[model samples]
Target: MDLKVDPEEMDCNQPVPVEVFASRSTLHGLSHILTYERICIKRCLWILFFMGSLSFLVCVCVDRVQFYFEYPHVTKLDEVSAPVMIFPAITVCNLNSFRFRSVTRNDLYHAGELLALLNRRYEIRDPHLVEESVMETLKFKADFHNFKPRPFNMFEFYDRTGHDIKDMLLACHYRGMECGAENFDVVSHRLSETHNLILASSHAGEP
Candidate 1:
């Protein structure tokens, strides 16, 4: 069989391996052999060096291949017993964070508007550009400038703006028994800056 390489869908081209290899190959010894320089011992040494290097490379490849399939531990299913499951706390926060109906007009105008504006401070160019209702809120009906804010009460403020657990739980039963807001604990949410309230199942210790 002819060893000459064939070009795809083109004329078959025969490349002289010895001549091409000598010209293009990076190997130093092969060129010397091609040039016919009378150094028999040097040629022998190059051959032995290449054979030994090939053997070493092959051994390294085989070793790595053998180690590739090796695992630290075998994977197998094992049965394990787990007892005493604790009830998880589910946080129930109001979709509408601030309840306008619960909050007083004055508080909504002064503190509520302030809170709303504070959230959108970076986004708004002018306070006048804000919603007409919000602008009207800032502008007092009796007096334009005079706006008195109430005393800061953490619990009271949260109670006014945030939703109550009692209002949410119309009907709830824990383990076939009647349950109410008393079963849950009131907690401040992170998103509300600890000013708004959220309901969570009180840790009763049993699931």
Candidate 2:
């Protein structure tokens, strides 16, 4: 038997092969998978970035909190007393070193004794002069009585040579002391005189 082919009917109803349909379906599924993978990768990157930023912020906050806790805030006038010693025997290289070694009560007493000796040697008769000299010796600037209490770190004043006496004297002037410069000169002279007297006395005693 002979089979007859109809061109018009074949053209009107062209049947797609199963393989081609499967291939098209596979391509569409592959495209969806690729899109999903890209989205997932982008999401993962964003999450990682966010986590890193959060960790950095947390670390900064913790550091700040630790600093705040370690150093108590100064808010009272009594808390801001005069420096015990204007010139320490040992020098501090930095503020951190000064913080580690603060002034003690014994240091304050020694400073007071030195001030008393200076007063006696200088023959300072005026009460105000005596008070001013004491304050200056303790690194307390003039008008300290009226100074507003605020958070202060004495270590900030420490230079490589522990505490610079010249700087402290300058601070005294800036803080409203009228005779800071003169006082410094007078105290320096008196200290020199006292040193000479001690040496002379020691020599006499040896004889």
Best by lDDT: 1
Tens-digit lDDT track of model 2 for 149-193: 444333232322143334444333222423332232211112121
Q: Can you tell me which runs of candidate 2 are displaced by over 4 Å? A: 1-38, 72-207
Residue 136 displacement in candidate 2 (angstroms): 42
| Poorest 10 consecutive residues by lDDT, candidate 2 | 190-199
lDDT of each: 0.57, 0.39
Best by TM-score: 1
Mind giving the per-residue lDDT tens digits that candidate 1 earns over 90-112? 45556666664555545544454
- TM match of model 2 to true structure: 0.20
Clashes of each: 0, 0
